[model samples]
Target: MRTAICDMLGIELPLLAFSHCRDVVAAVTNAGGFGVLGAVTHTPEQLEHELAWIDEQVGGKPYGVDIIVPEKYEGQGEALSLDDLAARIPPEHHAFVDRLLREHGIDTTDRAELAGRGMNISDRIGERLLDVVFRHPVKLVANALGVPPRYMIDRARAEGVSVAALVGAKEHALRQVEAGVDILVAQGTEAGGHCGEVTTMVLVPEVVEAVKDVREVPVLAAGGIVTGRQMAAAIALGAAGAWTGSVWLTTEEAETAPYTVRKMVAATSRDTVRSRGRTGKPSRQLASAWTRAWDGPDSPGTLPLPLQSLVSEPALRHLDTLAEKGDRGAQELATYWVGQGVGLMNRVRPAKDVVYEIAEDFAEAAERLTGAIGD
Candidate 1:
């Protein structure tokens, strides 16, 4: 816990939990760890409200916000409307979704009853969310997918907020450093959500060595890091801290869909697969009927980022509704982006308990390593 990251974050421990749920964020921060809110899915207005509520709950504890601005996606400076983006999704994809829904006995006729009926919006909305977080007391702002855009980096620097970038490769970490990112998140394939082929055990040291003399910025080990032992290992390998995500999904405060949380509890490390079916980029999620369809040779290849997002997002929303109503096939098809760490999460616990457990475990692990020296 006496690492550079703990000093930078002004906390006793260096466990950084990335979560979407406000309760989890508050709990982790209160337990002397950093809780980062994943804000890519929320609108600016909603994000502002969530941050304000977290501010009140954590009583001025430091936290972070994460956003997604992929280097390549469907709507790049074209200024496409939400309808335009929606239309780009091919009719065949829609038919495929409809067929899946019906095969699972989900009602397609009643669009009004859809779970996320009114939530669809434009990609430009993310900029507004970024602005809102900057106005608050957030200590860090992270770009989840790529190098920090110049505008975002400039704006955060102007506001005196630290900017972090998540990267799957050492090359990407170098690019982020060149772009003036204050921190590099070396995320490996074992991570949930978007990731690259390198394992955390390999990628962390590689990224650290790659950027060692460039700027002295911190490197947090990410991807498939779920326990105190894992955190200790990352620190031993030159990581300043452990950047985590999937562990939060099983927290009591998590907003994870009830059934999805159940699935995570029951899952093994091999239960997840990396596929482009969800976010266009390769993200690890539970292997299910939907993933099988996209990976099948007879099916059309998956589309690019936002285009693929367009198809997957609506279908997931619909699946949630069907899943709640006892549609077993739809339930079986239902999946969310999570890492192989799901196997390690056995029960729902409070986020603070999670933080303390990591700290305690990290101490024991470190002590054991020291004892092995037999000095």
Candidate 2:
């Protein structure tokens, strides 16, 4: 449908797909839906190459970028490099993770070798990413965790790109609008990745009313929104559009781990849990041994932000590698970020097809609503 987001972003539909796969992003954009690439883990060099590749594929079609810039995290403001952040990770946390893996039948002998740079949530990396973003034909940029930084907002403004931010609470939405965010994605606990406790059904309307007097900004409903009918429902809740992620994880073009994708396809809405085991912040993911161990009695507990990733990424990466090789223990521990809508995503489809399906569903739902009204 023609909503404010469609007009603002020069797209035919107000559907914004948040995906890490460049293929999915380009496909969605070409299908008349906006695609926002998640770059929290990408280096500047990597993001530049991705945006360049998307530029070639979309042929001037508008797309967006998502970066994590949490307001608070371990070693935040201390000029900590990735190495520094890793060093800050307590030995107890490392030992706990190793023991947890060992208990699950995973070999932890090469634990050091499995280490990888986790998410780039610091200003140092974010500033560099912004430089790469402006260097491409990116249409919008969003801070996945908190308010967009001054440099990010300024650079986007100078380049005429719209700025968006994801918020879980009404207060956060108000703060984002006051910070000059062009759009607000009211993400609820049902969403993947880091999220708050509110449900989307309640959060969207709360956010819409909270920011109405502060400024005129389109609110996009996110969390458990995987179909066109859900987008129509979001619009009914005062959202100008819908911001979706989990549904695309099952798409043919997705970068989700093979085993995890299979798990997602078979998962029910109740199978997901908001566990802080991965990111040190409550993020919705499939309930697995990894999450359970972290919440167990013998756990060292999760660390803050980037530091927690240090504890999780290496082990999770190892689990994924082994799970693909048919290790039962690894498979049981392997989980990925996904929303409760995994229940509705039963099949893998092409990204373009998914976009069109959503559009058609939205139309049918809208028409049904129109006909229901007593004329």
Candidate 3:
């Protein structure tokens, strides 16, 4: 459990669990591992409330926050209102979604209210979120999309918070290190959410070697790492530790919809696909009718970042509600961000138990490795 990340983040274990659920964040931190709350979906007001609640639960344990501020996207430098952004989405895209929903036997009629429901991912919003984050006791701040914006790194450094950025390519890792990131999460395509084409086994060592000359920046291997044995493997591959996300989706404290959880449990390594249907980028999720329609041959194609987000979230939100109510079609079209590791996540356990198990498993794997050195 002793590693650079453990010391840097001030935790007993190097296992870092990323979850959107506040309960999971507090539970993992309290159990010894670090928890990073996903804040891209939360508004400033909501983030303040969520952070305050986590502050009360963890009793001073260190934690982190993840925000998506892509380095390049539609309307990056533009000042557009939510209405202005929504207006850019063409009618064909909406019609395509409506047809897809209807094919699944759900009603998408007169749903104009769903139009501006997408999460905003602009510089202005990211700066506002950073302001909220700095006001709290967050020890680490992570960006998953691209290099942490210059202001983000500067502000985090000013506030004495470690800046962590997730990169899939060795080139991206170099960029983050050059940009002064305190830590690097070398994520692979097996990871949930937005990811690149590299595999973890290759990317970890590649990134570690790529940045050694620059400085001794710690790298956490991410993508489909669910078990302590996998965490041990990541360390063997030259990672300081493991950064995990999908594994926590099935934990008891997760807020994943009941039906989607069932689909995930029944899934295997081959069940997920890297489709851009969700956020207009290739994110790994359980393949469903929604993903297939957008990635299919006769489709109009996906939109750019936040613009594509506007079209998808509203419709998916509606389907999720019906899926919870036993609408079989909705369930068939239901999907959530997950990785190939879903095959091993067949059981649901408390977040604390999951954290303890990973730590214990890591120790056992380390002993086994040591024993191999002799005899």
Q: Estimate each model's TM-score.
A: 0.96, 0.98, 0.98
Question: What lDDT score goes with residue 136 in model 1?
Answer: 84
**lDDT of candidate 2 at residue 234, scale 0 to 100:** 98
- Model 2, range 14-70, lDDT digits (tens) per residue? 999999999999999999999999999899999989999999999999999998877
Question: Candidate 1 on 1-375: residue-level lDDT in tens?
Answer: 488878777777888899988899889999999989988778778899999999999898899998877776776778877677777878887777777677767777875443232222345666677789887899988886777678889889898888989999989889899989998899999999889999999999999999987889899999888899999999998999999999999999998878888889999999999998887778899999888888777566777776777777777866765777777987888998889888898899988888888888898999999999968
Q: Which has the higher lDDT value, candidate number 1 or candidate number 2? A: 2
Which residue pairs in candidate 2 have backbone atoms (N, alpha carbon, C) closer than 3 angstroms, thus clashing? Answer: none
Q: Per-residue error at 106 for model 3, in Å?
A: 1.0
Q: Model 1, which residues run further than 4 Å from truth?
A: 112-124
Highest-scoring model, lDDT? 2
Q: Compose the digit string of candidate 3's lDDT tens values, residues 142-231.
A: 997888788999999999999999999999999889989999999999988888999998999999999999989999999999999999
lDDT of 2 at 251: 97
Model 2 stretches astray by more than 4 angstroms: none
Report lDDT (CA) for all predictions. Answer: 0.84, 0.91, 0.90
The lDDT, on a scale of 0 to 1, for candidate 2 is: 0.91
